[model samples]
Target: MASAQDAGRGWSMAGRCLTALVGGYAAAAGLATLLARLLPVARVEATAWGMILSFLFYAAFGLWAFHEPRLARVAGVIWGIAIVTGGAALLLGVRP
Candidate 1:
């Protein structure tokens, strides 16, 4: 049987992994925005919702693939939040 202490430690590590994924995604998105400002991006005919969905979906999937259960769930939540934020930003027409 697994020890309680082991379980606790596992949970903590998983939490850290999830945190890292979400944090990494946010950092990446910010960097992308910066790059977009500094350099011209190829013009695309994509809608705001489409961009948001792709960004968040891939971010969450990336996180899940990189780690175990608890971490995956956390990353998933973070991606979800980002998606919602993206929607809000879209409605407000807030660029970056």
Candidate 2:
């Protein structure tokens, strides 16, 4: 029973780390692609700005993942943002 509890705790920590890394990256990339396509500036300038802003997004998501009380909720929010931004980028034909 004690071992089972420890295993569950370990799995929870691993899940949080995975969400912070993978989910954060996906969300940031999707946001960057959407912004790059939608920005009114020249393509080169917009893309550069988007890329710069994405770092902030990634950092914020990483922080939120650890701070949030529920790992599942954090994962859900990250995935939701990723899906919406990704779909919008696709619809806008953003290539990156």
Candidate 3:
């Protein structure tokens, strides 16, 4: 029988995992798209660079999500970056 404390801990961990995976992916994709659009190079090369950097972005976001103590802060920062970068890329006419 799981106590309330244990249940809360489980939920918290679940939230952190989801934020680190899904939210982190979103943030990485958004940043990659922005980079692809903004790099001053040939289209193919720019896109390649973005693709290469996306892995680092994901890893960084995942690490930060786990390192943060507050779930709300983690969610807000990760999702906020995802939305802002995605929106900027869209506005800049970068096709995802």
lDDT of each: 0.52, 0.89, 0.93
The deviation in Å at residue 40 for candidate 1 is 5.6
Give the per-residue lDDT digits (tens) of candidate 3, residues 1-96.
336767888888889999999999999999998999999999999999999999999999999999999999999999999999999998889443
List the candidate 1 regions with Cα displacement exceeding 4 Å. 1-3, 40-96
Instruction: Give lDDT: candidate 3, residue 65.
Output: 98
Better of 2 and 3 by TM-score: 3
Query: Estimated TM-score per prediction?
Result: 0.34, 0.86, 0.88
- Estimate the lDDT of model 2: 0.89
Which of candidates 2 and 3 reaches a greater lDDT?
3
* Residues 26-86 of candidate 1: C-alpha lDDT, one tens digit per residue: 5446433433333334434233334455566546545654555555565666555556554
Question: Tens digit of lDDT per residue, candidate 2, span 1-96?
Answer: 225648887788888889889999999999988898889889899999999999999999999999998878998999889999999988877454
